[model samples]
Target: MSQTDSYDDTYTESQVIMTTVKIIAPFTLTYGMFMSLHGADTPGGSFQGGAIIGVTVLMLAFAFGIEPTRQWLKNSFVVGLVTGGVTIFIATGLATMALGGSFLEYDAFSETFGIAHYWGMEAIEVGGVALIVAGVVITLFFATAAGFTPERNRREDEPLEGVSDDD
Candidate 1:
């Protein structure tokens, strides 16, 4: 028998995994947000926070199954997250330039509006880097789980044109 014949694609739900993830997901998400928001003054930053947030989704997938998780998060939301992040980062840099400062010059905000430069950095870390990283990580994970099929319209039982069952 071929490997495909023996391999089962069904998802088996595990009560323990579901329960554990349900209990821990909230704390992990909160911690991720905290790391992103407070990273300017602390050790963790947007990348770390974003990864953690992404992992939380993975954990959910493991507990509930990839198909369900993918259904819950929709394609538009992930794309929007990435797009919004890029917009925030670009807008911040452009705002600085418009104020007669170099790109990403947080000091421009301080000088122009008497606002703290810390807020600018926080915005970049929280809104730009964090969202971009999280969205990308989730997207990649989902794509990987889906696997690759050479022909989109091909049926599951149909073999590729060049490949033989004996091979």
Candidate 2:
């Protein structure tokens, strides 16, 4: 069976890459979480936090190896990335329409959920952030991995008829 690696393994064996990735991942994860949990109370929120998590994933892939990272990349992941954002956006819009207000009226959610408008808006904003982070991070990791692999390289010089370059 082929073993998959973690995103942090991009720099796996190298001492510098390993050390930096190790240190950065924890810090970024913590910071991201902090931002996410207190999104309503601060400048940073779930989106920023999600991006932080995404960054950690990217660093892990760099520190560890790509083979390990494949496990995290799933069909659901692609769907989730797009769906999460769209879900939040659509929900917000629908809420506004139902409430007879603008497209993203926070008043609708606030009233529906029995929360303050500020809170509703914050939730919507944060959710949007989450989707953005997921999509970006996943896409970036795949791109990075491709950059290092031979198969990822679309060499125009290679002959289509199985002819050798030296021929």
Clashes in each model (backbone N, CA, C under 3 Å)?
0, 22
The digit string of per-residue lDDT tens for model 2 on 114-161 reads: 777786566566677666676777677677666664334648766544
Per-residue lDDT of model 1, residues 1-167, tens digit only: 55367557899999998999999999999999888887688998998999899889999999999999999999999999899999999999999999989999999999999999988888899999999999999999998998875677698898988799898
Model 2 RMSD vs true structure: 7.2
Overall lDDT per candidate, in order of appearance? 0.91, 0.71
In angstroms, how far off is 92's CA in candidate 2?
2.0
